[model samples]
Target: MSETNGAWTWRLEDTSGTVVPVSEEYADQHFASQGDAESWVGEFWRELAEQGVVAVTLFELDRQVYGPMRLDTN
Candidate 1:
């Protein structure tokens, strides 16, 4: 999903490769650019871990930019 025209989305995911439900708590997961998405994950991954997000992924349309990056160290 597009955050805005010419922008990207920071999608939160579960271990099953399903998109996590978007909530008021995570309203900003979609970002203005890839860098912004990465930055959001970088800053809040620990919080995401607590919320049961095992991995994260990025996309522009059906194209995956990157991810499935793990939040848990173990």
Candidate 2:
């Protein structure tokens, strides 16, 4: 898993910790509120499953802005 800019990328790993092919768009669309995006993710997952992939586990990494803020009153 890796994060760059404001995008996050995640990959599915096997029990032995091996990287497997998982669609980033799928993950995004899986959580997306858009109907088209959700459909796309569904297709992606279907394709992956057709390739004899079963019982895959997802690992995720997220990045966000965090800082301290201070206010001054005049």
Tens digits of lDDT, candidate 1, 1-74: 33545456666889997877655566444566777777777887887877777898778756888887877888
Worst 10 residues of 2 by lDDT: 65-74
**Candidate 1, 56: how far from true, in Å?**
0.6
Model 2 root mean square deviation, Cα atoms = 15.1
lDDT of 2 by residue, 1-74 (tens): 12233232223334344545655533332222234333443445556544333433322234322211111112
- Candidate 2: residue 50 Cα off by (Å): 2.4
Q: Which segments of model 1 are wrong by more than 4 Å? A: 1-6
* Index of the highest-TM-score prediction: 1
Q: By summed lDDT, which 10 consecutive residues of candidate 1 come out lowest?
A: 1-10
Q: What TM value does model 1 have?
A: 0.75
Top-scoring candidate (lDDT): 1
